[model samples]
Target: MNSRKQVASSFTSATQIPISKEILETPVVTTIVSSSDEEEEMSFEADLWVSLTKTGKQKTPNMIRNDLQKYIDECKENGTSSQAKIVKSLAVDNDSFRKFMNPKNYPDQWSATKNETYWAATKLLEKVKHEKKSTKVATVSSARSKRKTSDSPCISQKKTKSELRSDLKALIARVHAVPNVAQNGGVYDSCTEVVAKIKKFLNRDGMTKALFLEAVLGGVNPHILAKFLAGKKQDQCETIVYRTAYVFFEKLRILEGRKKSKARNINEERYPQGFSLTKK
Candidate 1:
């Protein structure tokens, strides 16, 4: 039994491969960084971009306009006055304040109703606020909701710090169980498949709030584990898994060792992609 334990310990030690500086310094995946339910997991901003890119040239301005209009109308109908959410959803370009404000882009700049929404969104977003963000951040809200702010319909909400740690602890455990990133590709391939599946699901069904919070909070979506860590810091162990989790929606594909582009421009994304855990 002692020998067996020794063997297991050796195996575990062997698996703890040194992470290359190249890996951590790898060029971040580029993304238009930007939430969920069982019927509605992943982020709406990420989902929107997914649908748009998939449609390709086939997606006309009118189609985008209609979609934007529908989203705006729905928010107002639901009495949701979350300017932050609305702004984030509409403005995807990291630097362009008017990315979604133009008539050529999507929203009708001439119309009062749409223009109101557009200006409000822009005013809420501080310039350079997204500078530090990266590609992995495009999808997902925070793991926990803020106390029912004035905008929140709920009367109040709370979660102890212990609960947050417990949840993160479980998620890190699952990430470790996945193939090690230090070995070959890690969970990058699996990550891609899951993200594609999520994009397809959202595009096919369109938007539905009936199950949004549940998916965002993880009643049905496994991606929430990744989602929760979006745009957040990571420790040593969590960093390993963050690399794989980030692969799901990263736009920046280059790493530090790769050839850097001369004409390449960098933009800040809202969500985080890479992850790591500090403790054993």
Candidate 2:
């Protein structure tokens, strides 16, 4: 036994012997690292000119009218007959005048020539207003033609409390069916087929309000999942689904928080070496 122990110790020492520094040292090899050098050439040139041409067109009636009117008014004050010449030159004919007055026909002029045209048209409209004011006219009261509350029999109609309660109960029952259908991802498909069948049933019944409500609430139509779910009572269904989904989401959030807390506690207790959670 002592001899066997001696042989084992010798084997262990031989295997565990440290490597020499010379054997561990790696040879240095000269390696040429090559990279291409590139340069971007850039050039810029600018040219400019000045001229006496007008920057924008003077096409607006308001602008033309204002300038024309100002010139005419100045001529009038100076006791010159140039007003008649300007009017003759600028005044559109009755046919063209009507078209020009239309905003659609003269969009640019309408917008840009507002101030100028307003003054010009004001003068013209004053003449028209004066003419109209001079003429006598009869007036009629529109209130006499309006219908009174007493004329309509249905205006005072009210729904009964029993009717409202019945509607609510029916809607609740319909909502309960949604969860069963929605379970196992079959709700959308079931609702679609149901809606289509319901539509056909309603159409056969001549599209009455009762039929519409029944079809929508019962999910008795044959349509796409989106369309099937989109019922008259969809708002109510959405409310229920939203509440349920929100509850689920809240529970999930709480579970996640708990898991994180537990993980953090475990990490704090262990503090294992070389087991860092922080990214390098």
Candidate 3:
């Protein structure tokens, strides 16, 4: 009767073990799951990287997650949980990850630090950078070619002699010394010389009336000269010439003063006292 009771007790205990616990304790047959999952994720990254490089389009993590969800599910079903885990971690939804993946979508949030997806993303980013550099170089090359073609003397358009002469004549007429030229021989000579110089300047291909005025006026305001040339204001040639010369001379004097000051400092540094033979 005791032996019978022992058997009953053992059977009852065995039966009490939960079905869920048994399922948990059951060993899976897959042994290379960890290694296989890594390999699968690597393969997925390579394929995705190729897609990214070709399009130059930023892929959001959500978009990437959606695309890989099926593959991850299949891996998980196949007991390649490690591989699925890797893929899931790569597609982890976070602000930093999202910003890194689709920088164009969230430019302000963009960050470029090394992370779990750095290697895969770098493949695409590097390719994009190279393509942009190549495109920029090509654009610059095309622009330089255009500039060279346009700047070539044979290709450059030039004003006709008649047009140049007319423009120069108008420019001179605007700056002429009113009735002073008839009264003063010096004024008449200067006027004649100015006309001759303008004619010579117009005969050149590259020279313009504005350029000639710029040369004559040195650093003076060209717009003021332009106004006078346009006949919007009146000023005698003698007055304009005297004023320009005065300004030019004044600039020269200022420059000379600065040079003298620098020389005096250097001399003092060298001598340290009066250099004259007669002592104070």
Candidate 4:
């Protein structure tokens, strides 16, 4: 038994790998950042820009006016407000905006500026915000109705600190278990696949969009993440994953507060009975 123990210990010691400077300085796999309900998930502003650009060509004054009109109509149809006021705010007046929109009516001095293009896009985004709010309210209402129908309370019972800690640890482990960024080429292969994956894992285990956003804002810069996610270059996708993962890991550390708690515990232990033992 002694010989066997010695042999096992020796073998373990012999196989132990030394930690490299690179390994210590940088992490490979990090905690996964997840978002809350798909409806509540915040899209990168860059993604919004891409969508806006794809809507139509904004080079001409007419095109910009047309897009603005479409958005205004959409907002009004969706129970927003008066389009005239909105248009007047964007340009000088509703008639003036229309005149600029018409190729024949367009004045020689009234050239479409970058500011006009931006304003039109901004109005479109405002419409989108209204739609998103409506969707969120509907989703919450539906969920509540379903719970009431099933005779179950909509609110869940509170969990104990230990239970919360255990759950968090399990979630962290699950995050680590996901395939590495380098694997599967990092970027999503297809729209369908990405959507399905998000549905399956995004809000799972108390991982909410709020938490994801906090991590994004707290660690990896949100603007950088947005740029990478919105970019056309395929190579940038991996970078997004790495930055997101690193930030997520940092967020987990913050949420767990393990170090702070551990230190407190140590202090309590050393100062038991409210007395600190001083060296003689």
Candidate 5:
């Protein structure tokens, strides 16, 4: 009997366990629910607070929240964000202003101006104006100084006649001393004597020695005698003295070649015939 009783108790316990498992796995329709209870609780709390505030004559948090949102939307529509407005207002054609607009390139606190955009434009314009003015002033001053130097009388003054005559005599003496001239059968000596005689003759003709030397040196070719007369008639005695020296040197070279036993190739062909005594 006791064994039957124990068997019956075991069967009852096993059946009860399975029934409890089925009930947990497949809940009853009345026991199951959607998960919106927390949301509904929050909404009820918000409504209750709004009603209490209205009765107490206090502003509702939702009203304040909506107003603040409306204000933000209006500001965005009007392009009124501080940084955005500044960038727009400071819009300029200048490269510097463009660089300044780049946050990574520009300093955070550039100046005390409340509007950074307008400040940059004004500052750059002023700087460019000042630079142009400075450049103009510098150019004008440089031109004025250059003109002054060019027009100065001292810069254009020529050597005096006496100084020129002295220089010519010295040059002739140097030419005579050259070894080539000495070997040319005293041809250079004759040239020097001719020049001296011409100077004397001109002096006798009431021409100052300085004026005579100047005309000769200025391309008269005193050695030709005819050119010398022409130069004197033309009042170009300085040119005569100058051109005569060239002819004298050329003749000296020819004479030197004749004196050389081997007939030295002096290459006088390189010199233009009459050009040797012509003015530059």
Candidate 6:
């Protein structure tokens, strides 16, 4: 019995969810901030669970459920359930529909993400239900209109770093905007500058993927990801994200050490216990 009142494993409660497609695609175990300044993730237990579970295997664990999934194990008495099951049921659960859709009725501390999750679950169900017949005119046109900039050549509109950091896609745009001077004789930004900027903008969660993506790969270039991030069997997206972050933070350890050393040096010149070192 989930004390929160176990929701039915359905997706009816979700509607008009406002989350972005990019956030939906990211792996849930994503690092937000480094301990010293950055960090790594996607725990083995979660991976193992995904390997063993049959539900929602289509999407990466990095999305939303990782935060909401652990209760499933505790919920064993209710029988094995995945976030997918929960959202699928919520989609149509009339009680949830009320709580998620109406702001005035929102449960205490309940973010609108609940609605977003349901919407994702609903779309997922629809996709699973209709796996065939991809040749549709209107659908194709509609999709083209919504095409992600990351899927192709970068088309950047100028935005402040603050604006870019506020949203992942906006940050992606910043990462994508590494103008190639050789090709277009545009302004060239060194990789170091970009990495520094990314590290500065991210929060202290030590879980953000933006820092590592830029530090190792120059940026989360979707074009490059096709060549290096995917393998024949499992996707290496989460692997690279953590691997690079690990290395990035390991280097930061040196910075942390230096900071301590500087403090020690200042302390080394301490005044005599009872008397001042400086002449009166």
True-vs-predicted CA distance for residue 201, candidate 6, Å = 10
1-280 per-residue lDDT for model 5 (tens digits)? 2322342234334444546543332222211111222222111111011111322322222333333335436658777654344334435344543444344552322211122332333322333444566679979998997787788856654567777667656555554555543221211212222443454345432345444445434433335454444342123333434345544554434544534211111112222221222232
Give the alpha carbon lDDT tens digit for every residue of 1-280 in model 3.
2322342244334435565544322222211112122222222222112223233333333344344444446657878665435434454345545554554653212122223354343433343345566679979998997888878857755578777667655544454423322222222112222332334444565556565565546445656544433321112343454344323322333443423222223334444631222212
The C-alpha stretches of model 1 lying farther than 4 A from their native spots are 1-57, 89-99, 104-228, 232-238, 243-280
- For candidate 6, give the lDDT: 0.35
Position 233, candidate 5: lDDT: 19
Best by lDDT: 4
In candidate 4, list every pair of residues with a backbone clash: 36-208, 36-209
- Output the worst ten-in-a-row residue range by lDDT, candidate 5: 42-51
lDDT of 2 by residue, 183-248 (tens): 222121112223333333344313443434443334333333334345432232332232332232
> How would the candidate models be sorted by TM-score, starting from the highest?
4, 1, 6, 5, 3, 2
lDDT score at residue 61, model 2, on the 0-100 scale: 48
**Once model 4 is optimally superposed onto the true structure by TM-score, how far is the C-alpha of residue 208 displaced, in angstroms?**
7.9
- Show where candidate 3 strays beyond 4 Å: 1-56, 83-114, 118-280
Ranking according to lDDT, highest score first = 4, 3, 5, 6, 1, 2
- Candidate 1, residue 55: Cα displacement in angstroms equals 9.3
For TM-score, the strongest prediction is 4
Candidate 4, 63-87: lDDT as tens digits: 4566676877886898776677676
Number of the candidate with higher TM-score, 1 or 3: 1
- In order of appearance, the predictions have TM-scores of 0.28, 0.16, 0.17, 0.31, 0.19, 0.20
Which of 1 and 5 is ahead in lDDT? 5
lDDT of 6 by residue, 64-168 (tens): 234234443444556766644655544446456445544565332223333444334333333332333233654787588567654766766556656544554
Preferred candidate (TM-score higher): 1 or 2: 1
RMSD, candidate 6, Å? 21.4
